[model samples]
Target: MGNYRFILSGGGTGGHIYPAIAIANELKRRYPDAEFLFVGAKDKMEMEKVPNAGYEIEGLWISGLQRKLTWKNMMFPLKLISSLIKAGKIVRRFKPDVAIGTGGFASGPLLQRATKKGVPCLLQEQNSYAGITNKLLADKAKRICVAYDNMEKFFPKEKIVKTGNPVRADLVNLICSKEEALTFFGLDPAKKTVLILGGSLGARRINQLVESKLDFFATHDVQLLWQCGKLYLTDYEKYDSNTVKVKAFLNRMDYAYTAADFIISRAGAGSVSELCLVGKPVVFIPSPNVAEDHQTKNAEALVARDAALMIKEKELDSEFEAKFSGLMKSVQDQERLGGNMKKMALPKATEQIVDEIEKLLK
Candidate 1:
């Protein structure tokens, strides 16, 4: 293994941070002696997570611009200037062979400075619709790794590489049986299991839907394994019982996937990739709060291929019961969705992304 130095930057949410960690882990596996440095926004999740993953990280005084006029929006220019200066110093001091970005506010300045220094850079765009950070850096990126097809509209066609998004390596192959998973979660094996996920921080609407529909699940003989996320755990944990298991986060996602017969999830790109590998019937309620309504676009890509079903948040109040009831009752629909999702699984995404990184190193 070559003892090369590398820099990675991404943050704000688990969708961005986890992919960066996954790529770092893959590179570590291949080059045990290589040095890795992570750059992320100072107050974001990545500051804590990167260190937990066993890598040293530096934080930039940066944040995304607010959509409305606010104090934070006013500070964007100053923050960008400060981050750019710090990123340049970090790049010069680290002297990384290659810099990689998984989309986030911090990556914009980090990659921009790296490119100016004549360093090779690669960008991993997780969403079907590219984020502003990735779009702005596309011209200078030596290779653009992507999870979805036809990313030519976002990045240069020649540089685009459909390597897919990196997900947790442990989740790529699950060996837990349904019965074991049911026992682990203390649910009845006879009942259909539905896993609810609204990303790591949780979704308010999803939590409210589950709250109102607790009886709906019980009457239908379906067990609920709800990940309420950290944001709303206190508000919803009181409803947890034998039939419904509510948690702030799921540490053993492999076991959760094994227990689930069906899934209700937000359509973040990383979640979509993991769900595809898990091969379960999924109903995506793409969070309407994301950039460019990208979560909806991500879910649509699968829905178009008949790999999954989608229920927009706006229509959920009127249409959720009918759509959800139909899905739960039909074994044929469940099998078809699961089969199609499995076909779209890219289990080797982490390896493939590392392969692209290696190419740039060469």
Candidate 2:
């Protein structure tokens, strides 16, 4: 393996950051002598996470434009200019063999500058619906790695590669037993378990629904393993008990997947990919307040294939009980959903994406 220098840029959320990290980790494993530099937006989670993963990272003075009018919007031009200039300097100094972007604010400037400097660039678009930054970079990128099909509508058809989103390596081949997972969580092996996930910041509607329906779960002899997220931990921690296990975060997701007979989650691209691999029946409540309502689109794609179920946020209050109760009552539906989801799992996604990078380097 060559002692190649590589630059990776992505952040703003775990969906983008984790995929970038996964790709970088795979590259590092294969090319142990390689040097890596991660560029992320200042104050974003990646600024903290990348370093902890044993890679050096630089922060750019950049952020996304707010949808609604705000003081921050006024400084967008200045920030963009500053970020571009700094990105150019970084590219010139590092002289990377290749630059990869996983779609985030910082990636826009970094990949743009690197591409201009004649560095081979690749993009990994996790969403079915491409983000503005990735779409803009599509033409310049040597390859566009994506999880979804029919992305030719968004990118140059010739450059698109259907490499699914990179998921956690451990989850690709989960080996934990249900009984052991139940013991780890102090859960009952006999009772059906439903795991709820709302990302690291929590989903307000999901938390509210869980809180209101706690008794319903008990009445039906079902148990809850809810990851309510850090932001809402204090607000929902009071409800944690023997039947209901509410946590801010779950470190051992493999065990959680083993214990869960069903799952309710937000449909971020990364979460969707992981769920498909876990093969648990899931009901996605995609947050409506995202770019292009992309979460809804992601969930709809699975729903179209009968691989999963989804309920929109606005329809939650009127539709939650019926949907939840219907799924709970039918064991056949659970099996069908889980089976279909597993069929969609792309276990080799990480490997295929790195393969594309290696081709570019060669």
Clashing residue pairs found in predicted model 1: none
> How well does each candidate superpose onto the true structure, as a TM-score?
0.98, 0.98
User: Which regions of candidate 1 are displaced past 4 Å?
Assistant: none
110-218 per-residue lDDT for model 2 (tens digits)? 9999999999999999999999999999989999999999999999999999989999988999898999999999998889999999988899999998898888888
Model 1 whole-model lDDT (C-alpha atoms)? 0.93
Task: Give the clash count for model 2.
Answer: 0
Worst 10 contiguous positions by lDDT, candidate 2: 211-220
Error of 2 at 140 (Å): 0.4
Put down candidate 1 lDDT per residue, 1-362, tens digits, no spaces.
47999999999988899999999998998998999999999999999999999999999999998899999999999999999999999999999999999999999999999999999999999999999999999999999999898889998999998888898878888988878888888989888899999888899999999999888888889989999999999999998898999999998898899999889999999999999998889999999998899999999999999999999988988988898899988999999999999999988988998898999895
The TM-score, computed over Cα atoms with residue i paired to residue i, of candidate 1 is 0.98
